[model samples]
Target: ILAKFKSKGSLNLHLWTNCDRKSMSPTTFKSQLYTHTGERPFACILCDRKFIQANLLTVHLRMHKMEKLYLCSTCGMSFYSSGALWVPSCNHTGEWPHLCKFCGKKYITSGKLAGYLRCHTGERPYSRLCCDKSFHTKSALNIHMRTHTGEKPFKCKCHKAFSERSNMKVHLRSHDKS
Candidate 1:
C-alpha cells in the first residue's frame, strides 16, 4: 500500500489504508513510544514548541493548554505550562543542550534560543519606523502606520476607522455616548 501511494507521487499525504498496518517503518514505532511518554527530545527555542520526537516537532506545536506546574519564588512568575518553567530553570543552571552558532549564548528552550538570535541580529524591534518617525514596539508602529497607509483592517458598525481592533471596540462606545 505504501508502494502504491509512492507510485502515485502522494508522499506528502498521510493516508491510512484499510488493507494493512498504518506504520511503514520501525522508526515510527519509536516515535509512538516517545509520544506516549511525552518525552520531547526535540525542542524549539524561537517558540514555545516541542515534540517527543524530532519528526513530530516538524509539525507538532507547543500545547498552550498544558498546566503551569512550576512557579518562581523569587520573581513570582507563573507560566502556562511546565515546559516553560522547566526550560528557563535549565538555562539559569547551565543545562542547555543547544548552543547558538552566531553567539556563545546557550538556551534550554528553543523559544529562548530564537529570542537570543534576535539579540545577535539587533532586530529586537525596540522601535519601528513609520512615516519617517519611530515608535516603540510593533503594536505602536502598526497604529502609526495606519495614519499614512489609510487602511483600516478593523471596522466598527459606526463606520469609523481604527488602527487596531481593540481601539475600534472602544471607539464604538463613543457612538452610544452621544
Candidate 2:
C-alpha cells in the first residue's frame, strides 16, 4: 500500500510516507514533513541556523534586528512577538481571562488554555518521527529534536553551546562571575 490509487487507469502519484493528503496538498504536506524528518532547509544566513519552515526562519531572523514593537508597560520589557509580551503583561495585570472548559482552570493566555486542554484530552499533535516522542506544542518537539540533531542553539561568548536556553543562561553566570 505505498500509494492509494483510484482505478481510473492513470499512473498514481505516491505521496511520501507520513503525509496526510486529506488535509493538505502534497507540496504543503511535504513541507510539514521537515519537522518530523528534522530536515531544516531554511537557513539563517547570519548565524547559519536552520529551520523547518520559512515562517520560523523569518521569525528567527527578526531576533537579529528586533524592532520590539510589543512592550510590557509594567517592566519595560519588549518583544518582537505579541505572544511573547503577553506573559509579563498578564502577570502584572493579575488577569486570568482564559478559562478551561473541561477543568475550569484559569489561564492568562488562550495558548496556555489550549495547552491545558491537551492535558485533559491527552492529544499530542507534535510527534518525532525518529522516536515517536510526542509533545503538545511544536516548540517542545523542536527542542526535543536537538537531542537527535545535536543542535545547540544557545551559544556563549566563549563559543560554548547548550541545548537548553536555561542551561545557557546558567552558564552565562559563570562568565559574569569571571
Candidate 3:
C-alpha cells in the first residue's frame, strides 16, 4: 500500500504500518524523539521541556503555563492537547478469534490460552503433595496439602489469616462456628 502511494508521487501521507498513528511521518518521528529526550532547541522559560518544532514547543510551553485548550464535552474536563484523550481498553465485544485446540474454549490473549493448555496436559509440577495425591500448580496443591500436613504457611502477625489470605483462615473460622 505504501509502495503504491510512493509510486503515484503523493508523499504527504506515508502508510507506515508499524509506527504509531502520530509517529508515522518522518518529521513527527524525529520531533517525537526530541520531545521525549527533552532536547528542545526551542525551550520555554515557564517549563523546562524542549521541542524541535517551534509549534510543538509552544504547545509544551502552554502545559507549563497551565493552558488547557481541549475540553471534554461529557464532564468539561480539560486537556492540554487532543492526544491526551486516547486510552485503549479490553472493552471490545467481538468474539475471541483464538480457540483452544484441546478444549475448544476461546481466549482473548495468548497467555490465558497457554495456561488453559496446562489443564489438558496436567503438566504443572508440585513442590508439595496432599497425603499421597499429587496435583498440578504449587498454589492449588499447597492449599490442598495443608489439610493433611496441618501446616499454615500463610499467617498474619495477629496469628490469623484473613478470609482472602488463605483457605486455612476459612477452615479455622469453621472450627469456631461449630
Candidate 4:
C-alpha cells in the first residue's frame, strides 16, 4: 500500500508516514494531507503559532492567558493545571511520608531523603574532573569548579565581574561609597 502511494507520486505522504506502508487509517491520512497542504485550522490568538489539533491550541493558549484554575485550600497556592496542584494538596497536612532509616528524619520527597542518606554514608557522588575533590551535591561541585575555571558569571555596572553573587553585591557597595 505504501509502495502504491509512493508510485502514485506521493513523496510527501512517504515522509509523513516515515515509509510505514501498512496500517494507514483514513483519519491519519487526512491529518498528514493537512500537514503537507499547510492547512492548520487551529491557531493561537495570543500568538501567531498554529497547531493541527484543537486540543494542542487550547493547551498553548493557557500559557498566554496565565490561567491558574487549580487552587490549594490550605496553603492558598494556585496552579495552572490540576495535576500540578494534586501532589502538594495531597500532602497539605505537612506529612513527610519518606523517612530516613539512619537518622529517622522525615522528608516530603524521596530525592531529599537520598541526599540526607549520603551525609550519613559518606557518599560524595559528585566529583570534580579537574581535581580529586568530591561533593555530596552537583550544585556544590559546580560552585567549586568556578574557582578553578575562574568563570565570573556575575558582572557589575563598572565592567568588573565576580564568580559569586554575594561577592558581586559587596563590590557594588564600594561603588556606592564613591
Q: Candidate 4 residues 114-165, lDDT tens each?
A: 8788889999988856799998876677678789977776667688978777
lDDT of 3 by residue, 23-134 (tens): 3377775565653443658766652334588887767766656798987665567777776532111213455756799879987666667767778997875444224665
Once fitted onto the true fold, the runs of candidate 3 whose alpha carbons sit more than 4 angstroms away are 1-26, 29-39, 86-178
Off by over 4 Å in 2: 1-41, 52-59, 65-69, 101-105
Arrange candidates by TM-score, descending. Answer: 2, 4, 3, 1
Q: Kindly provide the TM-score of model 4 when superposed on the true structure, using C-alpha atoms.
A: 0.41
Best-matching candidate per lDDT: 2
- In candidate 2, what are the lDDT values of residues 5-26, reduced to their tens digit? 3433554443545555532245
As a whole number from 0 to 100, the lDDT of residue 91 in candidate 3 is 15
By how many angstroms RMSD does model 3 differ from the true structure? 17.0
Q: Between candidates 3 and 4, which one is better according to lDDT?
A: 4
TM-score of 2: 0.64
Of the candidates numbered 2 and 4, which has the greater lDDT value? Answer: 2
| RMSD in Å for all candidates | 14.8, 6.2, 17.0, 13.6
Clashing pairs in 4: none
Ranking, lDDT, top scorer first: 2, 4, 3, 1
User: Who is ahead in TM-score, 3 or 4?
Assistant: 4
